[model samples]
Target: MAGGRLSWAGLLKWSLSYVDGAGPSGAVSEEERRWLAEAVERHMMVDVVSRMREIALLMSTPPAVLEAQGITHDDIEDLLSELQVHVESIDMANDLHSVGGLVPVIKYLRNSNARIRAKAADVVTTVVQNNPTSQQLVMEASGFEPLLSNFRSDPDLTARIKALGALSSLIRNNKPGVSAFRLANGYTGLRDALNSESARFQRKALSLTHYLLSESHSDCSVFAQLGFPHLMMRLASSDDSGVREAALGGLLELARDTTLGNRSLLAEHDRLRRLLRGRMESIRTMTPEDLDAAREERQLVDSLWITCYHEPSMLRNEGLLVLPGEESFEQPPDVAGRFFEPMRRAAARRAPPVEGSDPGDGTGGGIVLLLGLAPDGRSNSPSH
Candidate 1:
């Protein structure tokens, strides 16, 4: 309609304007507006389709020919970045599926170029974040396998993180997708991710784990069976507040699930008690400038302490449930420490050594590695 190329927003504005003669129409009706919007999306969608085709052509072509044309994976990565922005819109996300762009995107999960793989996964992540429609579309397209593969074993940690993020989005609130994850043995992937040397990875895994556990108590058995209880405990002590918050969220769900043989799981467990107490002690000194995660961690750790101890925590007694500036505790953790001895003895006697762990190592020093923090605090893990 103008000298420059048309955009969806511009077309819609003109077509639905109070007064218009751009197309021999005067202020189109709402019904016509809907038609016009779809038309614009399909028309502008060529930009996306052309890029997707370019990526496919470039990727499938011989390396020698690609070199001859000076095409590179960086070009593919840039195209993916553009597509990601487009798919952030619900219509474009669905349009992407309508045109079969998902297949190539999924295929790229195994691309030789790590950056392209990560970017592809990132694009998938954006596509499925809150779009259940796209989530189902991806599941139907068999997008899970490649995403899970990258998340479970991709050499590049960024690819793994992006893949994990995409997986998290793919399954969230989608039962069939979650069942697919179950069939795919997703928990093991989660366990490995939990043990990663990256805080970003740990936070993602923890968040997804929390969602899974909270969705159904039956999963608690599966997770606990995977020895995730220990990992969750370790993660509760992460230096990163985001990781700690997510870990505490998972821990809270597990504690609330009384059906997973609830009593013996974590109740009156000394190490847990001590960890919760340590978190409690810090809640007192938090300032208003502290992050929301810290405040939520305080609430979760408080609830967890109460659930595990079956009594009001010091923060609870002071009504510190809200956060800093609120007065908050009543339980003497020292008294709680007394329970640790007996439980430790009982646990040591009955609990099997965690798989792949040293039999004699009673101290759970192998804390969950978070985004940039390694087990030994020496990771070059990429930040989110």
Candidate 2:
């Protein structure tokens, strides 16, 4: 009978192994991480609200054992962060079946101390990055707009850092639905960060600019109007490669449209014309709206092509041959053929493509190339 009882306890312990497993991969195994995500989801359905509360209590508790079997307080912190992410993912997954009580759980998310708050920000980020619908749900459940005030105005540096992190997450994740105040905050915060003494702050600011430029291609025109050209020139030549790359990428996004592309920003347009002929011929005919909708998709495809085509050794190894589209070897071919599926899938569901639409109808099917020269006078490829 004692053996039987011990066997039952062992089974329970085995089943609960996942409770302590989810963490940074450099700290835990891939299988453990996957199992933890699944187990956390299962446990959420069992007694999710209470389980989270129990974790909160445990987070405040001391560790009694350092044995191999039981979890430590540090482990709890890591696992709590992971569970927080899982809970947010569940909330964001748009499953109507989650317990209604999950409403309070999200409210609880914004309650932790600075370190925990940063962890919460990361959880919010995962939701925002992966699922838009969840972002709306999180906004509704947590009054995340008001939470922004705490993150921004907190006197503590830790609090401020957490808030900045959260703001970046919010900015990146909530695109079409972001409020005007959020945009205003981003403009203010990013502008200030640009002037910050700390290089870390400056890097984050650059990243924010990249995210904004890449996702909100519509706003590129405003940048030029606001003298972003000078700012971008400085950034492109910054000591930091990341900053330079981001500035270049943002400029690329902006120059896709006629209003921006036709400007002096694209001084290397002739080189781009030669390199990107077939690749971006469709972009020449794009309406401004089409350019906006397809900017991110095009960036991804362009990155892939650059990776494949730029390295001669890789090209030969892959047995890939480049066929010039014209006798003059003028432009790249309609590489759009390679990108057709991704474009078709990315076509906005609510915004139907117009009938008999041209390449730039913003409905779909085209590529835009933006070319700029480096200060050294070395020309970049169309893919760049």
Query: Can you give the TM-score per candidate against the true fold?
Result: 0.71, 0.47
Error of 2 at 253 (Å): 2.4
**Model 2, 1-384: lDDT tens per residue?**
335434555554655564455322245566875776576555545454545445545443433432344764356447546555445644533542143323433443455445545555555555555566665666666546544654455554555555566566655556543454346554555555555454565566667666766666666666566555455545544566455456556555555545556334444445433333333444345566654543543443254234323433322233222222312212667786776767565554436445687767434544443346768887655552
Best candidate, lDDT: 1
Give the 10-residue window scoring lowest on summed lDDT in candidate 1.
Answer: 362-371
> Candidate 1 on 1-384: residue-level lDDT in tens?
222234555766776664355456565576777777788767666655665555555555666787788877777788788778777878778777666677778888888989989999999998888898989889888899899889888999999999999999999999998998988899999999899878999999988998898887888989988988789889888889888888888878888888867545787567788888788778766665663447677778778887787788887777667655653433535875685577666665675556787755544423222345667878756456
lDDT of 1: 0.79
The true-versus-predicted C-alpha distance at residue 223 of model 1, in Å, is 1.0
How close to the true structure is residue 147 of candidate 1, measured as C-alpha lDDT? Answer: 92
lDDT of each: 0.79, 0.50
Off by over 4 Å in 1: 1-65, 291-293, 323-384
Say which candidate scores most in TM-score: 1
